[model samples]
Target: MKVIVTDEISEKGLELLQKDPRIEMDVRLGLSKPELYEAIGAYDAIITRSGTQVDAELLSHATNLKMVARAGVGIDNVDVAAASEKGIIVVNAPFGNTNSAAEHTMAILLSLCRNVPGANSSLKSGEWQRAPFTGYELKHKTLGVIGLGKVGGRVARRARSFEMDVVVYDPYISEKRATDFGTRLVDLDELVQIADVITVHTPLNDETRDLITAEHFAKMKDGVLIVNCARGGIINEEAMLNALNSGKVVGAAFDVWSEEPPQGDVIRQLIEHPRMIVTPHLGANTFEAQTNVAVDVSKEILNLLDGRPVENAVNIPRFDPDLMAQMGPFMELARVLGDFISQLAPENPGKVSFQYNGKLAAYDCMPITVAGLAALLDRCTDQEVNMVNANLVADRRGLVVEQGRSTESEFFSNLITL
Candidate 1:
């Protein structure tokens, strides 16, 4: 199998792929759209970073492509739905940069609070201006965190060590989880109102595009500090600038932006503001982060090539072929039953019990049950649900699931009830 590297990755990752006898590798960086399109047909797999755009047009030319691996968490650069339609697996290293990003958040927050960048610049330029750089400490401050996922959770823990009170706003997480993290869970409105320093760690989506707007800033404590290291659009750039100018927000630090390499006056004004600290999206730029992602994507590609299960596959499912064949007909029936039952039954179901009778009961019907659950959840989530993760997903949603089989039949040769 041939693999192409369209963007730069750690040399260690390339070596891992090279060590595999069945694979041949090529490194082709900085390819224009046309050139990349022309070069993709020869490779079975391709690994890329955010620099490469794996769009429909590029996928169309990739006749031989089996999988596209992203070296980092975000797959925004790749058209996942398009790849899914073409039966191509797209995977990303979601956990590889958790520490790096979390650390960067702390780094930026500290730098902004203390005016480290400004003071360093002044001293280097032969000036002693300590009075202008006076800043407050994190101790005894309330730190509000949004989207308590991997990076956000880590940030909360680190903030606790600095003697800061942490409040989290993540609807997805349970109260128990918040307690374990030593954070008090609150609604967005409450978090905004109470927090002395607020940092966002949510993905960019329609619901979160303008999450922190003028109104949100208006509700915040005077001279509240803000930090965003997750995505660009989660915080409104215009609203933040307004807050900064009015002294409602003392300082803001951001690693990502609404527009990378942003243009226009608003972005320029934010950059020029003395209280605002900006980095060139360097949250995941550490050497360890780069290597971790490289190793992760490399292992995922190797697993795919060797027909092994990939836990992080975003576009497809993995199933045992022998089991799939046996349960193929029952799988469809199970799905229909689940769909029909879900529509007729009450909302917010607590448990699902499956009973199989007749000759079909003699076979291992676990795969059939999984298929049914997948179909049931397919209606609820935008994610691709499959037999592998169906039960896992159900558990996460707090649904109880069980299955039983018997050779006895009531009316027909076989009976299945959900």
Candidate 2:
């Protein structure tokens, strides 16, 4: 199979793909939009970073493209919905940069607290100004961690080693998880009010975007420090600058920004501020991170070529590898049954439910349900409905989809009923 590398990746990763006898990999960088669209049709798979925009127009030209492998965690640049419609699998290395990001957070947080950057610049410029550069210690400080996922959890552990009290504010995490991490779970309002240092590690979405706004900052302790290494829009840039100016925030350490290559006055003012520490989104820029992400996506591509289930597909449902062979027959059966049932059912059957019976109910049944859903909705929608776009189409059509599992099945050893 032919694979193309449209963007730069670690040599280690390129070597891995090159060494595979069954695959032929090509690296073509700085290709214009028209050139990329034309050349993409020849490759079965593509490996790229954020530079390549895998959108609908490009995908339209990629007639033979099977997979899009992103070397990094974020898939924002890639139009996932568009890829899904074309039955192209999109994958990314989500865990490869966990340590790098967590470490960067600590680096900036320490640098901000100790005024390391300013002091280093001062001494290098031939001045030994010690008193002005002197800053506070992390010990005995209350650290409020927002979001206790992989990176945040690691940050909490590292902060504990510095003798800092770690408190978390993730509604999804269990109480047991908080206790296991040795961090107290608190509400967002409480965390902002009590934390001497606050760091955000949440995904930027409707709920989390502008999460730390002027209102939230107003509740913070005087001279409270802030750190954001996750995403750009999680914190309000305008409010952050105002806080820094008013001295309500002692300092802020940011690795990511609302706009990468940040523009305008609010972002510029934050970076130029005396007490703020900024890096140009370098959380995942470490040598090790680059190699790790490359290796991860390469291995996933190999898995797909071997007809194995993809672990990190953005648009596909993942099933346990061991159970895949056993589930394959049922999946096809599910789809055929859905097609047959839809023909008999009345018009506007408001809710469609997939019921898994017998031994199959013991494991994950979502994939089977999705397969059935695709066939059932195929005639109802204008689009070519498949497992990849079934859920999205169902939502758009205002159809309620549900699933159930039951161990008791008198008819057969395994069954997928809709």
Candidate 3:
């Protein structure tokens, strides 16, 4: 199998790929759109970072492509829907940069609290200004962390070592998990009201977009320090500027911006502000993180080539071994029926009905129904829909789904209705 690394990947990962005799690898860096289109057809797998756009037009030319591996967490740069339609599996290394991002968050937070950047500038200018750069101690301070996932959990643990109180907000995580992390679970309002420092670590989605708006900022404690190492646009830029000016927020550090390479008026002001600490999206810039992500993506590509299942696959179904074989044939039939139904139905499907006929009716049909649901809605949903939560996605979209099975005899041994 042939694999192409179209962007800059770590040397460690490249070494592993080179040692694998079953795979042939190529590195094509900084290629133009036309150059990439011309070169992509020969490879079975393509590995990339944010620079490459895996869109419909590009996938059209990739006749031999089976998998696309992204070296980072976010899949925003790749057109996942387009790739899925062409039967391409997309995978990403979501956990590889967890430590790197958490470390960067702490780095920025510490720098802002201690006024490191200003002090460094003053010393370089041959000035001894110790009194002006007085820093605050992190001990006894309240650290509020949003989204208590991998990176957030790590930050909370590290903060506790400094004798700081950690509070977290994540509705999805269980109470047991938060207790295990030794963080006080609280609502967003309470966190804002009590926290001395606030840090965000949530993915950008419809519910989380502008999560920290004007009202939320108003609720924050006066002189609160804010940090965002997650996605841009989670905090409203205009509202943040207003809070900064009003003294509601004392200092801010942002590694990600709503518009990358920030160009607007508010972004320019934030970048120029002396009290604001900003980086060019370097949360995952550490060498260790890069190597981890590259190695993870490489392994995923190799797995796809060998016709084995991938653990971090973003577009494929994750199934149990015993059940996978039993339901394998039904999945194909479901896919064909789903495709046919979707084309024949209206622009928006209000409901989907699944009916099972013949001797196969005695078996549990929930998994089959979900598999069919995934196929029908795979091309429509923004997020990846698998058999695990296909029904939930359908429910979220206000689509009613019904399932029924019968033991009546039919021409075929089993029949599935949609």
Candidate 4:
């Protein structure tokens, strides 16, 4: 199997692929977008970090691409839904850089609080600026944590060590978990209003993008510090800039930007602002993180070539091999029925439901339902719909997907209804 490494990755991680006799690995850097698209047809898989934009356009050109391996945690650069529709599996190393990102978040927060850059610059320029660079102490301060996942959890622990009271806002986690982490569970509104320091650690998804807007900033206390070392656009960059200017936010540190390579006038002005500290997306820049992430994806690629289950797939779910065998043959049949339903239903057909009975209902019927959904979307939308992304596409289009199963069939030993 042939694999293309489009972005720069650690040599330590690529060694696994390099030594493998079954895999053909190529490092082709600085390929133009068109070049990448045109050349991708020959490769079975591609590996990337954050630099490459793996969207539908690129997937269309990758006629033979079976998989996409993201070397790091974020798949923000990769259009996962598109790849899934194309029958391409997407995987990522979600855990490899946990410490690196968490540490960076705290590092930037401290830098912002202490005016480290300005103080260092002043001292180097021959000046004593002890009073001007006076900073806030973490002790007794309320630290509000947003999305207490891997990185946020670590940051909270570190803040607790500083004697800072930590409040977490993660609806996904239980209040018990928050207490274990030395944090009190709070809502976004309460966190914003009370926290002396606020840090975001959520992924950049539809729900989280621009999560902390101008309204949230308005609710903040004066001189409240903010930090965003997670995904960009989560805190609303423009709103942050406005808050910095208006003194609604006394100091802010951001390691990631809405646009990488930090473009636009607002970002430039934010960078120039004395109260704001910025870094070029270096959240996962640690040597250990780079190697760990690379090794993770490399192992997955090897897993694919070795006929082992790719465990970290973002698009495809892990299923028992035996169960897949039962559902595999029905995919075509389910798809045909879905196609029929697509043509038979009205333009604004509200919701879709699937029923499985008898033998079919005995097994997990999710794959068959998804296959039908893919066909349903094939005619209704321009997106390339397949079993992998059918349910996702259905949800995004506001086409509710519902399913039911029964042990007995009305007329046949096994039956599927759409």
- What's each prediction's TM-score? 0.78, 0.88, 0.78, 0.81
Ranking by lDDT: 2, 4, 1, 3
- Candidate 4 yields a Cα-based lDDT of 0.89
Itemize residue pairs with steric clashes in candidate 2.
Answer: none
**Tens digits of per-residue lDDT for model 1, 297-350:** 888888887865565777654345565555566778988988787777666678
Put down candidate 2 lDDT per residue, 1-418, tens digits, no spaces: 8999988899886677889999998889999999998899999999998789899999999888888999988787788888987778899998899999999999999999999999999999999899998799999999999999989999999999999999999999998999999999999999999999999998777688899999999999999999999999899999999999999998999988878778888899999998889998899899999999999999988988897667788898757667788887888898899899879877777789888889889988888888888899887766677777888888877889989999999989876667
* Candidate maximizing lDDT: 2
Pairs that collide in candidate 1 are none
Off by over 4 Å in 3: 319-418
Q: Please list the residue runs of candidate 4 whose C-alpha ends up more than 4 Å from where it truly belongs after superposition.
A: 319-418
lDDT-wise, the better of 2 and 3 is 2
lDDT of 3 by residue, 1-418 (tens): 8888888889896677889898899898988999989989999899998778888899989988878999988777777767776667789998999999999999999999999999999999999999989988899999999999889999999999889999999989888898899898999999999999999998887788899999989888899999999999999999999999898998999999888878999999988887799999999999999999998988887777676557687766554557667666887688778867766777678989999998768877776777788778877867666554566678778989998999995587788889
Local distance difference test scores for all models: 0.87, 0.90, 0.86, 0.89
Best prediction by TM-score: 2
Q: After superposition, how far is residue 87 of candidate 1 from its true place, in Å?
A: 1.3
Better of 3 and 4 by TM-score: 4
lDDT of 4 by residue, 69-176 (tens): 999989999998778767788999988999999999889988887889999999999998799998988899999999999999999999999899999999999999
Quick one: how many clashes does candidate 2 have? Answer: 0
Q: Provide the lDDT at 221 for model 4.
A: 96
How does candidate 4 fare on TM-score?
0.81
